[model samples]
Target: MEEFNGNDQAFTRDSLYGTASEPTYAGVTSFMRRRYSRDLQGVDLVVSGVPFDTATTNRPGTRFGPRAIRTASVTSAWERHYPWEFDPFDHLAVIDYGDCNFDHALPHKIPAAIEAHAEHIVQAGCAMLTLGGDHFISYPLLKAHARKYGALS
Candidate 1:
């Protein structure tokens, strides 16, 4: 078990690696309790939220999916990942990058905003695990990723 120094490791922990020791219910919510940081230095992967749902004409509530997923992940963050004896954090450096910021009013710019946001991270040599807003959001994300890694499947 990891050492428990206090709580709110999402904001308090300084390292980009290791499982958080804070209680699941007591700390700032980040994906799996990973620290919230924009710095890509030494980071292996970034879990970012893209909260835009204007494309989902039939179901517009998908914008809230990212936050809901993050909140739900709080519990799993402190527990051992299933189907494995070890935590991936033991060898990986991950962080929760919060969400993509864009003007919802400017729907045309949303795709670009998400693309740029992804480009910034991918360009920094970091892999992304995005919590999406809608199915359409994948277009921009894939475009950005394809630019870096080429023709994503």
Candidate 2:
């Protein structure tokens, strides 16, 4: 495979497609080294994080999982996803939309925040693959996705 030269493709690339050229150990980390943007203009997918672990009981480290996942993703961005003959990025425009913002001090508002965050992506004509924060997040995520696309059934 030929080497790519676009360092920090996550933030530098102009197109919605094509692979990043950055070295695995360098540059800012984004999902699959995709662009870091909320613009969603031609974006086909948004990888956003909830990062809310307040609902967890036994473990509370989920808030850090999104970043860890993004970091780990660096190693695999250089090639097509395993077991597949094609590169997903060659056809899809994906981005790391960053984390959902909410006032953690106010637990009651978290669900709405999550829903609104998801709503923005859906409204932008992009599908989302959210990193887990806590199981409770699913409740809001489901509601958000359903509201945009219809009933889960």
Q: Write the per-residue lDDT of candidate 2 for residues 11-48, one digit (tens) a residue.
A: 77777687756789988888888778878888888999
Provide the lDDT at 120 for model 2: 82
Q: Over 4 Å off in model 2, which ranges?
A: 1-3
Query: Which lDDT tens digits does candidate 1 get at residues 1-153?
Result: 456657888777777776756667787888888889988999999999998888877778888998999889988877677889988887889999999999999998888999999999999999999998889888998999899988877
TM-score of each: 0.94, 0.93
Error of 1 at 139 (Å): 0.7
- Cα lDDT, all candidates: 0.87, 0.85
TM-score: which candidate is best? 1
Number of residue pairs clashing in candidate 2, backbone atoms closer than 3 angstroms, sequence gap of 3 or more or interchain: 1
